[model samples]
Target: MEAKKDNSGRITDWRSYERVLLPSIKDLHRLDVYEENGGYQALRKVLVSDDWTPAKVTDEVKASGLRGRGGAGFPTGLKWSFMPPVDPEVPRFICCNGDESEPGTFKDRQLLEYNPHSLFEGILLACYAISAGTAFLYIRGEFADWITHIEVELAKLYEKGYAGKNIMGSDFSVEIVIHKGAGAYICGEESSLMNSLEGERAYPRVKPPFPAQKGVWGYPTTINNVETLAAIPTILNKGGDWFASVGAERHPGPVLYGVSGHVNRPGVYEYPTGILITDLIYKVAGGIRNGKKLKAIVPGGSSTPILRADMIEGVRMDAESLKEAGSMMGTAGMLVMDEDTDIVGFLRRITHFYHHESCGQCTPCREGTGWLEDIVSRLERGEGHYRDLDLLTDLCTQMEGRTVCALADAAAWPVRYTVERFRDEFEARCRPSLVPAGISI
Candidate 1:
């Protein structure tokens, strides 16, 4: 499908692109329906064929340029390769991070709700690739309805012999388990999710003995995002080159853009990566609600640095482009804002979420998030002083890169970026200091 572009060379007909992750097929959640539509064929191909080995599966995905759909855009196949040569006596595990707890990130929820079998197939493929017999699908506790639906569907897979011992009548046998998280946002972090799976307190573990080296139950494990795993089936069905050629050259493949906030049609839209921010806002999402002018955008999830309207002029929704534009392609969960939005109040609410969700494991995150919430709350109430802006920036430096996990960094980003990017808006809300220039507090 040829996309129509404006004079500016921006793709106007984004709808022309095919949807891979969230296809429009009906009853896709059902096993029979999924099978009818070429689902699980990838897994079968890998398991039954002599040509498609575990190493081959990893190599194909690596060729696809598939990155982690989770916050970090790490290469998916490279991650699977990290699993040490499988030991028959020892157990290796695949943890599917279905904890869709990141604010503004709801695409994974739709995947589980509408087309769960893809994720199941993806998980199985991952298990085969990593030489693991078991895969844990860790979902957040808040997705109760979807969890039940997934469990029901999973039972159907087992009954059909798609899962369990000698799946598809091949020697390769695997078990898929659905794990419901306690709704802790920190659990979305890989190490923390592993801890929760082991029935321990959900806390971020230090790296070095990283999950690939030492994971849940201290076995070699590979933790992948729900969307990341779900994309695997497609990579195998179509050649890896086909998938890689679809999107931004570096970060290729279709991505689920979860657009929310001021857009009129706020929901998940599947399109190739590197779609222009403007085309997504105007063409796909039907523009700003009520014709309000654009103000700012939290291009990725809440943790990604917020961008001014001008900053996104030529920005594309991919890791490299976003990074060059001073933001990260974090979940591609775009939270748009209108001209009338209260910048200070908006940031206050975001700060509150990170503050409440901090696992309290590290002092930087534990104490820093609380302090951030307090300062932002003060600014939102119009009680903040001009020095509070500098203080907020200072607190971010202390919190960022200091915590065990990125929780502290997540909390600090919006505050630091918002304060710096929208300094005038924040300054307008704050009371000016009475002290003379260069006066110390």
Candidate 2:
């Protein structure tokens, strides 16, 4: 695993890095294979050991600096600590979000498909920590095959006594239920997912009664992303400090960088956090397709603010660095655009997605998303006016932060950022305003 690096000491070869989330072991999804690779040892250690407790587990994860991989990047341990003290009379639940519905995000699917036991084990660990008897594993409905695969593996866990009734002959008993989503993008949101789980329409719930306080059927619940939970086993196996030492000081540990768009090798590459954007596009993903100059990037998923190529000159793929770089480390689903890319058309497509995915509960999101798509589509079709540009930005301002969920903000971001970053391209497509810039209608 000797990595070739430039003078800056950044690993130029992604292969040199050892993978944690997506390990190299063959058939690692199988219970025996996962067990052979040291799976569930953390669960057994925690459940059986006198030295470990729920608080200690939470603290260890806090020390690891692991953040939510499902767009938000909040501290996982801190989220775990939010669960109220375990009450034997009252039940708590652990919801594993496997709804990888974001357009550019596909890494969670691999984890569910290739190494599900880790997730199952992680779910079990979460149940113990929260003092919950039941855990719900929510997966996207489009992943029918993967859902079936997980079901088979889950049955194996039950057969081996790793799940249901008792675990490793200990007092702790847990049951995992697999709930398949209807492929709604809004269901990816924690509250919306909970609502959908409770047999209600998938709409993002209002806050204050946040999932921590009241969740899925009115139980104190802790919802974690699939990748976030999968990382738990490794963090517990290799001490949290060791996990913290692997990547960037602020946001550490291995991340499944799902690089897509105009790249020679557009696939999920497992590397430590804070990998230079250039190192990922050039070294890991085998550089831009056909050696074209880099144009722009949606550094996270489609929801994150888009960045011009120049803006990402020294950017690293971590939450802190990306924030400084004017974007977010959203799902680490980097969408690379080549120099010849159509900015306006790309924005049109993105706006369409958010518009279609809006749950319609929020007035701002439901209407605003539609307006965004209509405006972007108008520009793409060569019927937009120069005034439409200002209108788009204005619409974004009105839509952003006005909805119950971030979908409005998500829809607004690309419209605002793309128009601002690549205004020239948009201006080229638009007709001049009918009146002077200062004139009223």
Candidate 3:
């Protein structure tokens, strides 16, 4: 597990940040090869060196305007600040949420599978920022390979004096433990993840005892999403001003967008915020396969509302702009739909996903998601009563903010947007020229 340290060596561009992006073809997919590069340098830079104070790091993050890439785009620095500042006697903890389970989002895996060291670097940087000495990486169990991959990296750090007690010849020390979740999407929720880490149900707890003040074995902890932390070393290596300069004014820094569903190029793209949806699809992804015209798009992941292609002008890569557009830049999961995609059918598919993922602890989310999915499925299959549209919208209204967590609210946005904005198309779907036998024509 001893990774050879080489701080001077580097790869170029986005790959420059990734192990796969390493110059040597021979090192491709090899575990030890990653450490040979400047893998743990950031960790060493923070804990090993006394150059930058934790407060200085926090200020830079605030300047960067780096919002969380996981669903809610809450400012990362603000979240860190929310925690009770360092207590000399009390120990603080930080956990990196690596469960990339959100539908249409798979970018965290890229960071794990290719540029794991970058993620590891960010993890250590967060520990230093919060004055924390203990960190946990809650990787999704489905990605067992990543668990193995990062575990090896963690071991490498420990053996090389980058992790464990008395790290980097300093009194300040940090240990990162890689924990595997039992594959529940709810575990992505900070509280739920904390609960799961402690061998409890995945259902979310009501907020008040925010994870910052009381979390993970009852200690002040800072829980950060993977992509949120992965962007750190770059912020450190480059200055805060440099980090802020990369993306849109409000939401700065590069976003690894996972374009999927119906598109010509269905993979990851690392571009800065404010990347136009049209350009992301048309220019970068080469538009839909076989010259299909754009129909609707889910600007973020399935949680965000469905947006028409004409709404492209309003779509911004930042959370503020996306929120203004009646959706969110949630996890930057862009699902491009062609003209052939049925709006009703699309809703049905997403409804199923949400329904399946709902923790069922919140009554509203448990019932509402299922209700929405059932109704949407019926509507897509030409089983609509016109009254059902109003029913569905009402169902969403009940779900929004009525539940313990935003999961219910997340379920509601899409249904509400689809019914209000695209009612005609949905109603038309119910009355096809040749309806199936059981459904009313």
Candidate 4:
């Protein structure tokens, strides 16, 4: 995969591209190969160096300008800094969210399958920063292959004296446990993931005390995304300025963009953020499938607002740029649609996902998602009334920012954006044929 240097376009010269989070290393799956290629060296340096304290680690992360790759784009170092003073007597925890169930997003599965040890190295670094003794790697149940890969790598770490106590003959020790989720989308959320990890129903919790303050069995817990934590060791090895210099300033560091849908090559591309949408689709992703003209794009995952081809001009694939373009760089899952694609049918498919995934903990999300799905289904079947469009928008407005989690808002975003952008298609779907002038049915 090539990298994007600026808004100008994709850089085909792969030799010049900086691969940090997803670095290319030979025999990457093997622990010995990983260590030989400079893996776990950061952990050893931190464990031994007097200058490498938890505060310094957090400061370096902050300096790097690394943001959470898990949709929210929250500052990772700021989140780690929120943890209370690490006490030897008190227990702190780190939960690595691997629940990669978001529609159009599968980058985490790539990292877990191909480069499992990078994740472990990241978990170790995060544990050091947050003063965590135990780290839980929460993976979704559907990802059996990924889970197996992680389990195998974890056993190797244990055997190599990398996971257990007295690691590398140092007092700093940490344990990593892998937990498989029951295929719930809500479990991807930090608070909800903690609940699922505790063997409770996977429902989102209200945020008064955020996860950093009290998470997972009432401890000072910091939950990092799989990609966010996976990039930590790289940030530690290279200076923070180097990491910051790679991507956009606001959201720096390497980003894994999972391009799907009408793209000729639908795979995860590890490129720096701030690449233009046009360059990503055409240059990196091998353009539209079947040589069809571009129609629309879901810049992020299914939950993000849909963007018409015209709206994509000069739009960089970053948080600030997308937000300014009336969308978000959510999960960096770009789903392209060609000219032949059915916009109304696409809306129906996405609405169905949110409807099925609603945990029913919040009234707006529970009822609102179902309502959106029903209206969309009716429209698909040519049974929709003219007022249904207005009704759908109203329901989405009511649901946005009202639920315990962003699931409701996420559910609402694509609906409102699609309706607002492709109103003609939605209107045409509602009424199969226009009534003859002055001729009543």
Listed per model in order, the count of residue pairs whose N, CA or C atoms clash below 3 Å is 0, 0, 0, 0
Candidate 1's residue-wise lDDT over 139-158, tens digit each? 99999999999999999999
Worst 10 residues of 2 by lDDT: 4-13
Give the Å shift of residue 117 in candidate 4.
0.9
TM-score of each: 0.96, 0.96, 0.89, 0.95
Ranking by lDDT: 1, 2, 4, 3
Sliding window of 10 residues with minimal summed lDDT for model 4? 6-15
Q: What tens digits encode model 4's per-residue C-alpha lDDT throughout 1-441?
A: 435455533332333686766677766877988888899999989988998998999999999999999999999999999999867787999999999888999999889877888899999999988889999999999998879877988999999888879887878789999998888999998999999999999888899798877899998899999999999999899878778877577787789999999889999989878888998999989999888999999998998899999999999988999999999988998899999999989999999999999999999999999999999999988889778999999999999999899999999999999999999998887864466699875
lDDT of each: 0.91, 0.90, 0.79, 0.89
**Regions more than 4 Å wrong, model 4:** 1-15, 432-441
User: What's model 1's lDDT at 320?
Assistant: 92
Clashing pairs in 1: none
| 1 against 2, candidate with superior lDDT | 1
Top model number, lDDT: 1
